[model samples]
Target: MNFSQLQCFVALAETGSFTEAAYAVDLTQSAVSHALAALESELGVTLLERNRKGVVAISNAGQKIIPHVRALLASEAAIEQEARAARGLNVGKLRLGSIESIVSPALLAGVLTSFRTAYPDIEVVLFEGAMHEVGEWIEQSIIDIGFVVLPARGVESTLITTDEMNVLVPYGHRLYDRAAVTLDELYEEGFIMEKTQCMFRLMKRFGFELNKDKPSIRYQASDSATILAMVREGLGITLVPRTMLPKKLEGVVALPLDPPQPLKIGLAVKAQQTALRGTTLFVQTALSWAHEHALLQTVSS
Candidate 1:
């Protein structure tokens, strides 16, 4: 019935134990039990069945109540944030999830600098993660906004920017001599690619399936610098977003992929839902920055 009680119940359901749930919600075990009992008595239904082993949701009671509890908590938090913001002070936290490679020190520093200059009192929290993990964060409302590559299959977002995916190879590599390389041209070459959903979609776009067994997979890595480093050492070649490459990764050459296989970058928010004020501002700033800087337009193209 009460927000505190619902909080306790949700925590208990997630943790599967009274002790663990109490620790998670910062309450004592007896306090958590009391709250759950109060909530069930008010609803006239049992929410959880607990025993020596653990707790389980026995009926539709738990399922029916959870969404309500989650919504209530979210709104309550939003209210608090609104109250703080109404004081003419930017004091609430902003949770932004982004791909690790895209959030390099330079880009992050620039974004933070611009954000702080505008909203000096606002606190920004950055979460660096893989594209898949960041998507989950956005879906769960754990993050207010995210900078990710598209086409994200299920999320609704605005296209903030798009960067071309270029082949970075060693200076003397066979493909480097060509004015532009095609997917078929590199079909037999070794490739170091990011192991993400984007990679799969990109491969699908190229009409080729990635095979690890192709004797040419000389190196495998997730970071662009590492991939380029490996390429510099003649380990193998990689296809990376053009924005991700540092200006001075020595001994490496970036070439256009014929027909241009580009990585569409965008700011993803919770699809079809209202956004928080802070989140809205961040998304707007990001889009403005991308457009003003012509970040989406590739120099090579």
Candidate 2:
């Protein structure tokens, strides 16, 4: 099938809505429908099933074929990238994935700036989500490169920086003014929790396990700002990365763990063998920028 039909299939599979799929691919709804209809007719198989409310669900065949479709799209992009590269053109697209808690807000802006200046023709698209989502996107080839917390598994990674986990509590709390709080103390009466796999993995890295005696989690939040707001209201205490703190910590006391725990942040790709040339440069530029700005912590290279 033509790339137009394939693109239509992928966009519909991702957005699950014909209208949003059309918007994503810059096509009219009717055009997208026609393209998909042509594709299914040619394949002799149904790829998408639609409900009465217009939500699209992947049929069994679609589920099996979708991964190959994504890979085919990625291969097309890579081919286009190489054609431009052979012509001595500095043009390509870089898609990045990340979680909010680990990326340094200021340094990431600088990283983007340096990357843009170095490859002025390259288009950068960012997809921000939770850590697991970022990892999944990298593995699924949905993104060219992504930021991940090390020591991670199932992807190729280059260390960028090492960060420490911290705790935040409202003013006037007994532990608010402590020098540092221990993980045991914090989990003994577990507070509001940040919903990230990296946090638990970070603890696991430091010889702490939440499995034996699971901490009591009163509330869970995905956004760091919302977690801070929850703590500010004294709903419960929460732990977070220091880099995640906002410029102003008005009503919360941010404290480090007594035995400081380190979280390593890095860039990931599915594999270097399949990575685009631009993706390699983006990784190097990010490492260079981190070094130039003194953002590099424990991890080197």
Candidate 3:
């Protein structure tokens, strides 16, 4: 059946009366009844039962068709919105997200400056959180898109850059005098680690086992600022992607590892969302920024 037929059917099912459904859709009661009759005939099932009281859901077939009708209505709305954006009349709040550590005033200002210059009328809102939290936001439709490090599961993404992980140490520390060091050198040192599942994947990549029984972990945190604070106080050292750092983070030094490892950063949206213009533009800006800075190469398909 046609989309208009499904719309009329769904409204009738929800309102439970032809008169009410007709008012809701701005159609006459006769038109609503005729559309529903046509739909029932096409599907070979009675979707509504009518009596002196009112119309009611008649069978399991009606319940099954309700979801499909909702999907069709949503798709139609998306098509209209996308068409408007394509015509250069884009106007809406763009929900955005990024890992908390990388939301520096300098970096954010630069990206916003560029985006606003292109789409000045679009309102942009940014949410900063840990990677997992950002991923959850994207999945739940709470945010349109997010920037996160990859080898991430449960979401689809377009890679923007790969950032080498660095060891953050106090400037006066003995290891600070060296050019680079191995992962084993920091094994016995008190370590500041991300207190999440990400820590395991990152450590595992370096051939290090994160056993809770070990006493190496001196502190745990969910954000990079606290990780830096701990390192600044000479409490311990932690691994972080270089892009997360701001200039003038006094007392802490970023040292490249002998066997360097990098974390992949990308723009990710819900894999099932077929219409997200703001998200698509944001990903393009992210990759363009990375390319201009020579920070990352384009991702091979």
C-alpha lDDT score of every prediction, in listed order: 0.72, 0.84, 0.73
Off by over 4 Å in 3: 1-77, 102-106, 172-174, 193-201, 221-229, 295-301
| Alpha-carbon TM-score of each model against the true structure | 0.72, 0.89, 0.64
Model 2 lDDT per residue over 106-225, tens place: 757888999999999999988988788899998888888999988678999999877788888899988987999887776665578767655665666777677655666778877767
RMSD of each: 5.1, 3.3, 10.1
Candidate 1 residues 1-301, lDDT tens each? 7788988988787677888989967999999999999989998998898777756553577877676576566567567767877886556667788887544454556666777788776678788887788888777665677877777765678777667767788989987777787877776787676655355456566675766665245555766667777789887888766776787768988888888876677778775355566776777777666665664445545
Candidate 3 lDDT over 234-289, as tens digits, reads: 99887766766766778988888778776777778766376466666767776676
Q: How many Å off is the CA of 43 in candidate 3?
A: 24
Which window of 10 residues has the lowest lDDT sum in candidate 3?
Answer: 292-301
- Which pairs clash inside model 3? none
Candidate 3's TM-score: 0.64
Positional deviation of residue 255's Cα in model 3 after best superposition, in angstroms: 1.2
